[model samples]
Target: MPALTAPAKRLHAAWLASHAEWGPGLHEDGFGLLPEDDVESPAGFEAWLERLAADSARCTYRWITEGELVLGGIALRHEGNNSVDRAGHIGYGIRPSARGRGLGTWALGQMVEEARRDGMDRVLLVCAVGNFASAATIERQGGVRERCRNSGADKVWRYWISLGQPAEGD
Candidate 1:
């Protein structure tokens, strides 16, 4: 597996498709939440990148890959994001074609490791209430479900994973 890298031109097709599929909301990876409008075109995406690259941005963004093929992305927020409450410190997603494999779980572990390195004792993750796959991924990483809360129009299950503990399946 290759190390995390900044979003680049090569990932356009997959990134766009991921955005299209996700539809109408922020694609939260450890970096800051990406507004749907921000990625509508090459120029917009570049502008978004410019904003994220700013030192004042509170999040770190990275895309996971295997060689030149992008697998997924993760974002780690250094500052508390007001959108999903203070607990939702990380967010990630795999492309549609990459789902069902263990990539989500793997990527999440890597993200948690990043958090631990940054001195976080625990981190919060949330998935749509019906998204059992994501809940399972979080659970595999030692996530303990806290509760389901309504956020905007959707209800999400919140989980907390302690960095010092080992995951149940990994």
Candidate 2:
């Protein structure tokens, strides 16, 4: 909602470009239209970008710390629309190319900060039980796993992050 004030322009552009390639994975929005990259030929991906750029319902954005066009993560606030499935208070992928560098952990921390900023005393995060990477990401962000269960073919792990007290392991 605010203009980029510094070295954030690159991160903004990179973030948009990555989102342009979004596939069938869960998004912050409950409903997903195909990404430009997935819906069209390579030649048409650019056109798809044009369309996505024109829509306001895509995703609310943020300006990360200055001097990094390549961001650590993109964070979304849960409108509770996608909370039942793919969308939650937090949803992130480390740009595929950005994986294994602890960006997910960093992003989760940022989401926690956003949750605190939004005045939520606690937040719920769910991940497929076998999604060990995601589960670890949440744990590193101070989430305490409450339980795990089956969700269709996927096992889901549920956790709670308490903003009312010092973070776990801190």
Candidate 3:
């Protein structure tokens, strides 16, 4: 079974493998990776991890792993910062090879529990309008469609999940 684990140095190589699968970009969500994050080098990766640790008060980051292999990442933003406003309270992504296995759905459900434990009444989740898989995952978690807005050339769909209620698949 896949479990959510904190970002650790021991998973550097495994993380790199997963990063490679996404090719090159800062588009990988849920990891909280920033533009300045250098995850390719061991030292740089450590620095990035340290940065994430420093921001733990504002966000929670985790990796979905089955043993030593990294399958994906999930992040829960605790504070209502600009990121939370734009990207929503949660963001996640599964590795390409791990797609279609319900890993995203499972990970998202776990994160919702984490949010509830943190005392949040609800969370906002946004996905590209074209991303049916992500939309489905969020909907399965009892996410209600709020509105759709334009972000550059892409349309973004926003949903809200109330923690007061049980998730659909739970």
By lDDT, rank the candidates, best first. Answer: 3, 1, 2
What lDDT score is found at residue 94 in candidate 2? 50
Better of 2 and 3 by lDDT: 3
Best TM-score among the predictions, by candidate number: 3
TM accuracy, model 3: 0.94
Cα lDDT tens digits, model 1, 80-128, are 6564363377788776677888888888888888788777889888888
Judge candidate 1 at residue 15 and give its lDDT. 66
Q: Give the per-residue lDDT of model 2 (tens digit) for 25-139.
A: 5452211235434433443545444554454243333433334433333445444545334445555555555558676676567667766766678777787777788888888
Q: Residue 130 in model 3: shift from native, Å?
A: 1.1
Q: What C-alpha lDDT values do all the predictions have?
A: 0.74, 0.55, 0.92
Which has the greatest lDDT? Answer: 3
Superior candidate under TM-score, 2 versus 3: 3
In terms of TM-score, which candidate is stronger, 1 or 2? Answer: 1
Which sections of candidate 2 miss by over 4 Å?
1-73, 79-86, 165-170
- For model 3, residues 95-149, the per-residue Cα lDDT tens digits are 9999999999999999999999788999999999989999999999999999999
